[model samples]
Target chain A: MTAPIRKLRVATTSLAGCFGCHMSFLDIDERILKLVELVEFDRSPITDIKQCGPCDLGLIEGGVCNAENVHVLREFRKQCKILVALGACAVNGGLPAQRNRLDLRDILEEVYVTEDGLARGSKIPNDPELPLLLDKVRPIHEVVRIDYFLPGCPPPADAIWKFLTDLIAGRTPVLGHGLLHYD
Target chain B: MKTSNSEVSAQANARGARAKAARPAEANNVFTIDGREIPFEPGQTVMQAALTAGVFVPHLCYHPEFRPHGSCKLCTMKVNGRPTTSCTLPAAPGMEVENNTTEINDKRRLLIQMLLVEGNHFCPSCEKSGNCKLQALGYALGVMSPHFTLFYPVRPVDASHPEMLLDFNRCILCELCIRASAEVDKKNVFALSGRGLKKHLIVNAESGRLADTDFAPTDKAAEVCPVGVILRKRRGFAVPIGKRTYDLKPINEQADRFKPLTPLPKEEF
Candidate 1:
């Protein structure tokens, strides 16, 4: 018998996205068993590993919207040989980047201070626990060199499977017709 | 159209008169796009002929009913080894055109990317996500990402209209609305002003609000927007995402403009 194939270590994380992409990734359903045979998980929510040890593939969802996101993305990029921006958020800033047009302070003020339902003397949060928000919500590629971009609201599970299979087989991933939808 | 190619040459080859005489009358008015013979009328451009032939040459701002604006360069194709806009370039017999090639589509992707980043195209949030032509073209042409730094150009939202909304953030500057308003509606209610970087659409009224003008929801201009700019108020997400135009069929296949009309017939030439 031939030698058993080595499982590729794949890592995934979300930055500013709604976690819809992560949900879509799980939409692979029973394919998870097949995927496990091809790739092992590292630092992904699926594995619950807090830190990423040198990984073969890193699939990151969402845009870089804060200081913590930048650190996580850069660290993840350093560990992975190939990094894929997972969805519309990570690829082109997505819905979170809609706030890019407004001044950050004004938005904060509108939300925390002048809003109707706020409690008396409510103000912007300055908790040391919270990650500092970036002035503009930006695509992750702005902070790190991305190897591949898979774009969609939450790229359909079928598209994700196709991309992952292509990568697993050591071929260039191609999201074909009806696969690269934004919504 | 090149000014040098006069009417006589346009109808029948001025330089290839002998070759033209050898062919049948119906066969004389034909050109090849991607090496496939595509016939054309005297005044028809490569775009019209290709559309008439049921061939899809990806385009924006070249509506069948209106004059070819050629403003949006999405339909740029190689005409005789030179880059030329197909929408305005008058079709001439035997002129080779290269369209739907990897090279052309790649350039078109870059063009689409530029259009995406130049404005704030947050497709997920935009009301026109699935229905928008720009977004559809992005999908159809395989634009993996915006690929450029987002300009996030600040533009006004004209919610002044009771029945409509003008979200300038998504405008690709195709000016189809302007043409539709002026030519078909007979109401020059919209006009584009300013220069590059500053270029934007303006309402014709002194108040500069869409409601100040008599633009109705039924007007052609109201329906001509290829993007999310001109929208009907309170109609957001009405069609659902996956069922909208370009969602049901890829824009290239839906372009049905190619469903064959025998190149305008020889007599119309």
Candidate 2:
């Protein structure tokens, strides 16, 4: 008898976020063990891998508010079969969406320039590797085509696990009860 | 804990009697804001009715979902010539109200401007630049610079959550997030940690980082932040400026136009 299709390749990354999305994943507690058995995390901070390769799923956990985030998201879209905008920031730009209200020049000057800023020793390194901050924060789908959206500030862990299990089982994921629905 | 037949009947009759008595009182009463005449049904607020009537009043703390805290003095409107929070003020018929005036505008502007300087509101670098309610109101009132020096305290970045960023530098102490956490989401994740101008947002029960707290990324408190203080991780700068919320219309106008159970179009997604 043929072995069951036990594992799927998955990659996850954060862009311009506080890493709460990943923490939410951890908050799933014991459910993560079941998740790990079903999916192989190829490139993730938890795994400490640098670049993304081909994967069945790409879980992006932040808003694209900088040049680096845009670059990484583009790569994930190119590599992954399905791209999930996994949180409020990834979907509606979350609280960072408020930054879409401000001008980019003002942001740079406030952090880098001004007497109180530089005089108080706010350092802006001249490192070429650092990604430049964008003028505004934007949701991921606006930059690239997203297959699905799991919108919460950070989606609950059970919701994330349920969505993945549904997708793997070739079934459409149903929304959870009440306000917990990942809309 | 089994209920007897007589007890159940008595409870049912009592509930029926209460419902009947409540219906007439609810029908007879009309909601009003700051004493202005308004047709109000059940489950409506004074602020909701006033905004529906095209009366522009100042407010910072009263969001639609949370109970009115009456903490911010910005929404203060004169009811029977007495200053009161229109958001919390109950609707009563034959109540005279006054909102539009140079005096009120001046006070509102000063209060907002003070909030700007109270924090390190480096407007130039602020993520909530053009789209900020605080900034828009400041522009409307011709507040060019913070007339006073900024407090310029280097606040901590609660970078614990992987999906969101909490920068205390941009907070104006509006308490929208706090109310959203406490009342709407039923999660008391945020609280005012300090006093007066030195006040800052603290996470968890103690003065711990947000990562240490039980703050879920999906909490309304995270979503309700008015400034760039609480930022989502990966979704910023994904959409171009032309497509963002600020580019459409001022938030105040938008809020007024679509107040109290206005259905948003699906395309708004």
TM-score per candidate for chain A alone: 0.95, 0.88
Show the lowest summed lDDT stretch of 10 residues, model 1 chain B. Answer: B1-10
lDDT of 2 by residue, B1-269 (tens): 00010111323433443444444334555433323335654344556667766655556666655566678677776665577777776666444455544555567767876786566554434455555566555534433234343344567677878677888877878788887888778878888877866677788555477776777878898777766787778766676433546445444455464255543111110
DockQ of each: 0.37, 0.01
Give the per-residue Cα lDDT of candidate 2 at A147: 79
lDDT by residue for model 1 (A1-183), tens: 121278788899999998899999999999888888778899988878999899999999999999999999999999999999999889888888888878999999999999999999999999999999999999988788998889888899999998888778776777766677787
The C-alpha local distance difference test score for the whole of candidate 2 amounts to 0.64
What TM-score does the first chain of candidate 2 have? 0.88
**Interface RMSD (Cα, Å) for model 2:** 20.9
TM-score of model 1 vs. true structure: 0.89
Per-residue lDDT of candidate 2, residues A65-178 (tens digit): 889999999999998999887766675465664565566677666778763725666655568988888876766877888877665556667767767777877766553332
Model 2 chain A weakest 10-residue run by lDDT: A174-183
